[model samples]
Target: MTIATDKITYSFAEYLELEETAAYKNEYQDGEIVPMTGGTTDHNKIALNFAAYLKFALKGRKYNIFIGDVKLWIAQYRQATYPDVMLIEGEPIYYETGKTTVTNP
Candidate 1:
């Protein structure tokens, strides 16, 4: 059987509220809240390896590496997602006043 999609749409504000106390992480796409599943071994391995390699290679540099749990905000598209690996130069641009979400990567 094919996967079912959520028909109900949720507002950004509502999503933020639910995410505050939700047990699992969910990605916000436009007006849809898509729940995330656990990562596979290969996925986790690659992401972790890349972040670790970059962390030492770029040490003493302005670039910072972030993996999992950190949400990236795409304002124009109204999407909030967790990238496997994110490399930011200088200070991260946060979304609003929250540290969990970032605008610039």
Candidate 2:
């Protein structure tokens, strides 16, 4: 389900601060923080199955497949989104020092 916001604008820094403590995930669009909706059971199953298949197919290869929990930081667009699936061939390029966010997929 989607979480409703107050419609007030926020700076990127402010958004990040709020996101750090937010119970649910939120998408950053420019300067707005939009709450993300949860996926259906079918969607979750599909994503997990796809990731599992990729892991099996790419076995012995140098790659990492992430499911829906990781955050993707798009620097150019100033957006942080959680994709259904993400694959990074090599070491991920992290956005910050803690290594919690990645800039490259």
Candidate 3:
């Protein structure tokens, strides 16, 4: 059997099951799966800097800060994406990698 379609399609759950041990980063939008290009040195540095600042500012608080490689799920977009920085407060969602499941910041 062969599948036919004029559009790229994938469910959020199926997207999650893709083999990705190496952070083969990707982003999804409107039923399309787009590979994520690795960030440049400056991009990474900026992300790190922002995460650091959030960490310091939120010390002893319930919230935790994170940087790149962390997946942020936007259900409204039906997609999971990487954000430069994220802050999670209260009961946090955990993923297989021991990071928050989804965040926005």
- For all candidates in order, the CA lDDT equals 0.92, 0.86, 0.72
Q: How many residue pairs clash in each candidate at the backbone level?
A: 0, 0, 0
Candidate 1 lDDT tens digits, 1-101? 99988699898878888999999999999999999999999999999999999999999999979999899988899999999999999999987888988
| lDDT tens digits by residue: candidate 2, 1-105 | 999877788876687789889999999888888999988999999999999999999999999998887889887888889889999998888766756678789
Error of 2 at 19 (Å): 1.3
Best by lDDT: 1
User: Clash number for model 3?
Assistant: 0
lDDT sort, best first = 1, 2, 3
Clashing pairs in 3: none
**lDDT of model 1 at position 86:** 97
Worst 10 residues of 1 by lDDT: 5-14
lDDT of 3 by residue, 1-105 (tens): 999879768876667666255367778775677888878999888888888888888888888676776787777767778878878786557644545366344
TM-scores for the candidates? 0.87, 0.85, 0.76
Model with the higher lDDT, candidate 1 or 3:
1
Which residue pairs of candidate 2 clash?
none
